[model samples]
Target: MAKKPDWSKEEQAVQAVQLAFDLSNDIQRAFRVSAALQDMSTADMVRKVLQLPYRRARARPRLTVTLKDEDFELLAQKYRLDPQDRAAIRHRVAEELQGFARNYLTDSGH
Candidate 1:
């Protein structure tokens, strides 16, 4: 019988290291705008611009953002949803975004 090889060390070796960049506000906003226009996450856009290989796209596409109390209040007013009901507020926001994309994003989905 042969002894099994350890896999924990190999797992750590293959793990990706996260990196951070301290860019100016204007540059950050520009990157974000470019990514949004291309329907990509900012990280993916940056990697593509640098010609770096990146992981494949997820099975299900999604957009994520952190909404604070003030954000919720504003969204509630604009969406006429109950601010206390976060789920409803989030669903409405998603619906609104879908509407915006359906209306504005070109047929190419860009």
Candidate 2:
């Protein structure tokens, strides 16, 4: 006779919506470290990061900018950005620039 597998209720619940993917070693390490720092499981950290209500402080048209290495370094220093993540650096710059624009427009009555 084959032995039956044992599963907890929480495990069974997660199985219903669980998704799996292969991540690079660096990203996996970062995820695990972040989860440990937050005192949460990697699964919960992933869920929180990906599951969003999608709220924005203001609606603005999207724009892209190209920065040279020196320029990026300057921005990273000024903004204290994470140099390893280009996408995150871009996002932080965009948000800061948008806020400045909004404040300037309001002050100038535009």
Candidate 3:
């Protein structure tokens, strides 16, 4: 048997609903540039323009990138690791990013 809904009626009433849509490439780029120039996230800028309530910020900030299967394979090859060992590849990628920051910081005397 399928499991029942986890949310209570009152809880569901207050749940946030996502609004997502696609835009043409030119329009999308313009929107992104506008947001960046104003130092606002695209989502936050959109909310302000639409007169919607702001989102609650996460307690911890995190960076994210979406990688395709081919991208993963490339990373594995670059790092000389098994493609199946995704965790190790991710660790290596993180190390590379940290090294990049460290190098820039040292070079710029920051």
Backbone clash pairs for candidate 2 read: none
- Pairs that collide in candidate 3 are none
For all predicted structures, in order, the TM-scores are: 0.55, 0.38, 0.51
Count of clashing residue pairs in every prediction: 0, 0, 0
Q: Candidate 2 regions off by >4 Å? A: 1-61
Which residue pairs show collisions in model 1? none
- The lDDT for every candidate, in the order shown, is 0.83, 0.74, 0.81
Residue-level lDDT tens digits of model 1 in 1-110: 99987779768778868889999999999998987777777888789889997544533568789988999999999888788988889889888899888877666755
List the candidate 3 regions with Cα displacement exceeding 4 Å: 1-18, 34-40, 56-63, 68-70, 95-110
CA shift of 78, model 2, Å: 1.2
Sorting all predicted structures by TM-score, with the top scorer first, yields 1, 3, 2
Q: In angstroms, how far off is 3's CA in candidate 1? A: 7.3
What is residue 86's positional error in candidate 2, in angstroms? Answer: 1.0
**Tens-digit per-residue lDDT, 1-110, candidate 3:** 99988998889978968788788998778777776666666777688678887544533445589989998999999999999899999999999998997898689675
Could you say which candidate leads in TM-score? 1
- lDDT computed for candidate 2: 0.74
Candidate 2, backbone clash total: 0
Considering every candidate listed, which one attains the maximal lDDT? 1
